[model samples]
Target: MNFSGLLTLQKERVPLKSIEVELEVRDHVATVVSTLNYENKKNKPLEAVFVFPLPGDAAVCHFSAKIGQTQIVAEVKEKQKAHEEYDDALSSGQQAFLLEESDQSPDIFSLSVGSLPPGESASIRLEYVTELAVQADDGLRFCLPAVLNPPFNPQYKYRGRKCKSFEVVYVPASWLSYSLSFSARVSSPRPISKVESNCSLDPLQYLNTDQTQATVKLAAGHKFDRDVELLIYYKDAHQPTAVVEGGQASAEPGTLMGDPMVMVSLYPEFPETVMSSGTSCGEFVFLMDRSGSMDCAISKSEQEETRMSSARDAVLLLLKNLPMGCYFNIYSFGSSYEHIFPKSVEYSQETMEEALKKVNQMEADLGGSGMLEPLKHIYNQPCIPNHLRQLFVFTDGEVWDTKDVIDLVKKNSDSHRCFSFGIGEGTSSAPINGMAKEGGGHAQFITRSDRMQAKVMQLLRFALHPTVTVTWDLPKEVSVTVLSPPIAILFKGQRSLIYAQLTGQSSEAAEGCVTVKYSLAGHPSENQLHFSLRPAEDTGLTVHRLGARSLFRSLEREEREHKEHEDGGVKEKLVQLSVQSGVSSSFTAFIPVNKDNGDTIQGHFLRRNIPKPCEFTGRNFKW
Candidate 1:
């Protein structure tokens, strides 16, 4: 049966109309409040399931809704318990809201608004805080995800489903009912230099004469066709800065959010030669995905180039730019993998020409997007001597078992560094980022307006150079810890972020100093960063929340690696943190109950998920 046949529709109406985003940036952390205005125009009370996207690292702090004159606040509970409660509420004619993260992809979330009376409107507000990632150009980058790229879904033999390809038709931004209104107030320790965006924006409004605070907003007329990206620059952006935040008063002491936290940012000043001279020789392996879904367009506009074509162009560029006397090879994978050569060959004019001709002839004829086997094949090969091994992956990132791939890369990290390229919009960030993080490399995203050449070249430069490894030495009374794993590689223009808890109290008169050491170009280097023990004016505990997020992620990684699922209170601790900090995690969910007494609308209520335009095809698909 077709996808629509799987769903029973009793009443139908538009679920989403407009989105309003309000963001606050203090130093390097950003807290965003997004309000989604939804209307139920159906004749009967109905439930609406809306699937949306958010940044993978976002720590969701709040979820609430307003219907009529009543406001409903959501509570954090175990995922299964929340689901059962939602079902009971809906059966008893009570309005309910359930928000959950997708099991397969952390970036995708689903929201269910149940028992909405006809002719009524529900306004949803979600608040989250996340650490801002520094870009390669010394600018802070923020992306408001708009396009929900369709992933490749395959049928298994047990399911007995057809193996036909699903198409997603692209729709222009003009088709959306309302535009997005986004505004942000930014405050930093350094002076603000400039703000840039992929979309139109109003002029910056400085809040003070020192130029440390500014406010900016998106222009009135904007086409929400693609992801909205902003690059904010500050004067002397590379300088290291430290922030100390007080813990929440309501929280218990000695807990994750109960104690004062310190956030340290270090941008290593490596010698210029360390990054420039290592380009002479290396083993470069390119893995490209040519699954059938790759045939679709990357942008909402059908006029944009297909993902397969873009991959071809990107590979061609890299092939021509490879350093002479280096080992290089290309492998294309779908259901199976095929290499242009049996083994890596020297980069020469003849090899480049042969690769280009084969690349041009490549098509999206691969049946499935399974990449594990191909990756295993690539890893099984022996590394060439006297050459640094760098593995570059280009794909739309639609694999089912993302953690498996990350685990494989992690196991082989000592042999080679990995650079992952997520092609097209709606790509899964979990895999792209996980591979790079575990493989000791960096991840890059390529969208319609993004220059593939610039991003590819950036990764090439990183591969050819050696990155410094950083370590911090703290005082005996004070211990430093990272929420994530220790630093493996430190690339130029990249920020080294550390979040730690200050357990023992230090006198206000006492000063705290940290010694950071790293080896650059086979030589040792050290730097000192000192800050006052006294707490600054209490910011909203942004650092505590971010640090907690990091700690939770680290535990998750451990659990995944060990397959303990939640051994040693790892699962329990994660839930407790989510409940106390108001952050959503894999084990917790947000469920809200509306106590408003309306007609007990109960019976087989139909379900409808707003369909998103697919990048591969312009046709719409519902999952």
Candidate 2:
């Protein structure tokens, strides 16, 4: 099966017209609303299918489509049930829309608009909320991915057929028929220092004299060729803050959405002396992707540097910067994997030279991207005694079993820290960020106009930093249960978020404290934040939904790792939370069928695929 552009049974032009995006930032959280306009120019009724990408950790809370004068909002339902409803609607000569998350990867989503009469236009609005990632320079980063290169997943089934191959068709900027318009409004408690982007933007406009709120927009006639990125900087970014959101009024009192949730942002700081004196004892393992796709140019620019070459240079820099007496190893994988040494060897001149020689000779000759085996090999190796094992992974493509890979890393998280990097455009963020979040490390993406060395060095610093532990202290009357996963990794100046369910009761004036204590280079250090129990106003259940998403992800991972015969009821729990919070999950989809008799058209429909403009470089491979 071909997983190219908007795929349809017929070979007609795409029906998608334009896309409009509106972004609203409330401090560290961002809410995005995207409207996709489509029209059926064909003579017969049309059914259009469009597959797209989203941030891996985003919580998709709203989906609806407006057909002419009527707007039909979708409801979260079980995946199978939703599909059945959609199919039933289509069979009965009715209008229906279905939005489902990919079974293999959460970042990929498929939207189906069925039974649109000829010459009719429809507008689809999708809304999602995500926490902005904190960059090394203390900027809150947000990206709107433009490329639609579906990852190569061997087990991925499209329209009930297993895909034999995956190919990315790059449509040049000049050939793009669709247009995009974007604007953003940012509000923060602290002063907004500045707003920057890779794409040209209008001058920032502050709404208030305090400089806490601002607005910006993308330049007119901007080409949708690459991912649109925004870097927002705020004064005193390291100051820890907590936002408490009230529970949904309609939800059950004891449930996830029914109870108030608290989101705590913590930034740990270590002593200057300890940070300056980095550790010299640790085990560093480097895993590089040598898939055929890595041969593509790193970006759409005029530079000739392939992803593999840039990765090699980054690896070389890492090798030369390794502290003395540290144990290290190098491994590369494509269809198969090869290691530079039989086991991890001490960092020495001769060992470094031997690894550098093989690194320079590496090529993107591997037929397909199979990373599970190499990762297993690396994890199976016994860790050296008295040394922290740090695993650094570099990849420019996606794998078939992203959840499985993440599960494996989570299972082995206690043994090592995994730092992941995505080298080029169209790289899957699910696996890149999943491994890092689960394995207690950091994830970075080197995309257009990004220097690989700089990002690599940032991660290296995080890898060599000291390991720390977190603890919280609250008022006696108000007990807390963490909804998100435990704090696994911490870096100086980078934000670490914790979500918790605040049960019991406390006075409006009651206060709570959360402390983070860690040992840096054998020296103990701590950072603390005290906050009030009063819930933040006008939060609109954002924190509750985000907390539900975090818990849902954790439960899904547990369900995957559960034994076949185990009756853990993880699936049932996931569905309950998804439905209650109105968040899309792997088991749930947004399916809405327009029951209005006037909207129904009694005619056979032809399937049309909407073509999305992708990057200038493409990757073609068969599993």
Candidate 3:
């Protein structure tokens, strides 16, 4: 059958019935457990495939399914081998479940359940751990994806089973037939101040008198149309703290999981004298995506505000408010790239007007989103003297070659700092956040509900000054190793996370101190944080898993750098880490098997693609 016919048939028979989510936040890291219930309401046996979204940086640690009275556990295996096993099992009439990440985007995942008998139900549960991203307002943000709006990528192949050309029909949020139940428990060293959400939530419940622990849940009635976002605020949220977690007892000694670990949270606050200082000059490059998908409405209910128009408004705001005397240029890309000026020109009324005029006339006529050439062109330009170079990128983040773009940004990081903005719903978090991380800058998301002016102003304010660089000294006997990214740039009131393995043994009563020193506006400031050497009770290996994930990310970056010189060594190491830590990666997948010896059905079973409900208008959603 053709793709549309198949989609029509699948729409008539929805496989997913309900979803439940449980979350636990300890310090800065969050562990999410999601359960999806599926029923075969059809008269005959069938296979069901579902596609979903997740945070790009999440480390999926567990996947399992319960069929009837039997609970089947999934094991991590190489992606290709797992697919082969799944296909073989399906052909042999054995029940199987396969889960894998999307090759195009890091935030999308595909799950397939095979050989389900008639009138049977399967409850699949998955768990992942990820660090919470700090919002521009200094609140910790947690997002539960409710929509996976596919991006239009005519040039790229769609490897996932749900969509043929990245076209997802938008279903309104109020029209969801299935309900969702979500709850979260948050524990931190600081006092809990308040919890805010875009969706309605029950009253917060504190677990203790000090208010260090709290729990919150979605109210009884919530429409599952928009993504659920939680902005958590804490008393003294900017104050730094250090936590020590004990090693896992079941793991080998001296390894990453076997050793005790220390995590230090740094909130660098320079003196007022340093804060008042500002840079007099800088080079600003604005790169905007004018791809065809930018023509789509920013939200299903809001057809008037297209992504292209919003971006143009944002660019105009930026151009009008740029620092006087700074050099700036604008570039737009679709299938190809073009720049408004041949070279960086000083920010003046005339120059700003010229740029604004061109930007206003721009349209989403570009065929595809190819960012490499424009980036290469920007980097190849000579650096103007005494000007701090900052590159601001605005896009829906629809590119398929995410890794290559990130690697390019990482390679040119020393030349310029990058500030990225994701402009639409379901924008791939990989490129937006990845570029910021590699280029030593910040990432901001602008959705239909968000005000473009506020976010753009925030970026402008951040770009007005150079990022603060912080360094620290630890005890000599400790010999600590930093597992997370090194502190390259520090923004005031922004949280800096440092994860390290404490290798040497210390006395229980011993206290280790960390002194963070940084220079801002030519002034040197320092903050000292002292933590006890005693390890806290075992946290069920949460810290170890997070550390493993950090290690895996670093190793993957190194693998990309050594792609030409390496001989599969990095892949081997990645496999070992993934298998040992029980975390999913680009190289690994989760596959569950059902060994029940029921009578094998001789007839063929139909396949069904379960669609998630999202906001949609009468117009077909293209991207």
Candidate 4:
């Protein structure tokens, strides 16, 4: 995953689609945007940031690594005592922030460094191991401390996921081409447990050296309450963490620019079509929460908009995308049940537009959150023959208490499937994804307005699938090593359906026997997972899901892994892609976000924006 690309641009600032960084070892990675700091002790700080785009307008803010304090280790004792606040060693020189848990980005993290003493200089290089732990869906953000004024100022970009390490190596004018390469050296024989089991993954490497490592130890920890310090591991604790980015700057500095960012498109490693029951008789019920929180948005100002507005936009889009001959109903929850369609309407050309209007009619009630009651009422109803009931639930992913709704979904799991769409800045995809996984459906979110339509259409397509029970059997071993084994079904379902990716094995076995069992119509149908290493076959890799080169990458890895086998033909392709799209293939790899921005460096999610349009609707829900 070691990668280095040149970026030379003369612009003040630009919005990047993505960026990625790579390294040879599994060390944490750090990125910086180097610009001249003129004033002495100006407190000119910068931060990196990003977000996971959820379907239905839900967004989560996160930070990957953390800086506990900015106290510096000055070589001069007089200066250290004079700037005691900035020189405090307790949290000051203790500035190397590390990652706490494993996550995919557009989740946010920042690296903040203050102005140096006049004539003094410092450089930072992020480090992480190049292991299978890093995967697609992780991301990075580079942000400077913010000012109260317009601040689309100078910055850097990252591609999909960053490599092991990528940095803007700081150098003094005294030396030309005297840049330091961000490199890592990782070697260990045993596993190190940094994070606990499901709550989080362990650290990439153990802290054997004092200068290079900082550790956060927790005996009994609360997911949201636990805080640690480190650029890589500190911020990964509670899904996403927010930090103050870009400090108070009195004046704008000259911009430091780079080439346009580039992004690698990602596709689901699952079946493109929905598993159906043969005939298309389905009913969809959208349960939207128009409570107080829904009125929130990620505001540039303090009076941020609520989740309600975005939820309405997303639902209207869903209403417009309902398939023909489908029966659907839309409802809103606050203290009472407000039905948009009045009665369960049989979907058609005539009714779809009306439903859209109804969805648009919704506005935030500003009432407190109350969703359990609505779910309870919906679940108590009896079954409907020849109809697939899908509940598309929208909320800020919060209700204070959700067990009641979960119980209701559990009660109705046999006849109905619930697809959860989360919305808002505080919205958590984990709940919706959990609901979907429990009730045989999927979850998604919408982080911004522009992504609303595509996110909605993707959900509709996911619901429109012709079958259910999209299962595969791949010799268990072939299925074990997949880092994020996208269960060839999540392509059209919700959530990721990956199992595991096995390496150092057989190629034909990597392309082993896969039987897909699905029930679509009155006929109850199924398809076999027939994939091959041969490039010529239309394994649907290149044909179904937009037919993009990025989506169908397994073939290249398969071919390589087949050639490298000593058994003797297991090529590098299988194991190689574990860092690309395959399960466990994620590492800190760099990708360019836009054609104009420089190379981006974050974790993976920058490339795999959460709630990606047209991906699997069925996300795995294991909180």
Model 2 stretches with alpha carbons more than 4 Å out: 1-6, 10-13, 68-70, 148-172, 463-467, 595-623
Give candidate 3's TM-score. 0.87
TM-score of model number 2: 0.89
lDDT of 2 by residue, 278-391 (tens): 665799999998766676666655237667787788889899998889999999976668899999999999999999999999876654567889889988999898898999
Where does candidate 2 have its weakest 10-residue lDDT segment? 153-162
Best candidate according to lDDT = 2
Worst 10 residues of 4 by lDDT: 255-264
- lDDT value, residue 142 of candidate 4: 15
**lDDT value, candidate 1, whole model:** 0.71
Tell me the tens digit of each residue's lDDT in model 4 across 1-623. 10111101211111221122222211221222121111222243222222112211111111222122222221111111222223222233222221111132211222223223333323222322111111112221111212101121211222222111111222222322122111222211112223232223334445565323333222232222111111232232212111101111231221000011111111223333434433445788888876544554522222344466677777777666666777888878764567765457788877887777677777655244567777776776554566778788888664534434554565577777777776633344435654775576655554445545665666666544434343334444333222221332323423232322222223443444334454443345455544432122211111111111222233433443455554323323433332222122112222212123321222212111122111112341111
Runs of candidate 1 with Cα error greater than 4 angstroms are 1-13, 148-175, 269-271, 300-302, 448-450, 464-477, 564-568, 593-623
lDDT for each residue of candidate 1 in 409-503, tens digit (9 for 90 to 100): 98899898898888776665777877876787877777663567887877776643444444555456655555656776666655667788776
Compute the lDDT for candidate 3.
0.73
Task: Give each model a TM-score.
Answer: 0.86, 0.89, 0.87, 0.41
The model with the greatest TM-score is 2
Where is model 3 poorest over a 10-residue stretch in terms of lDDT?
A: 1-10
Arranged by lDDT with the best first, the candidates are: 2, 3, 1, 4
Cα miss at 51, model 3 (Å)?
Answer: 2.2
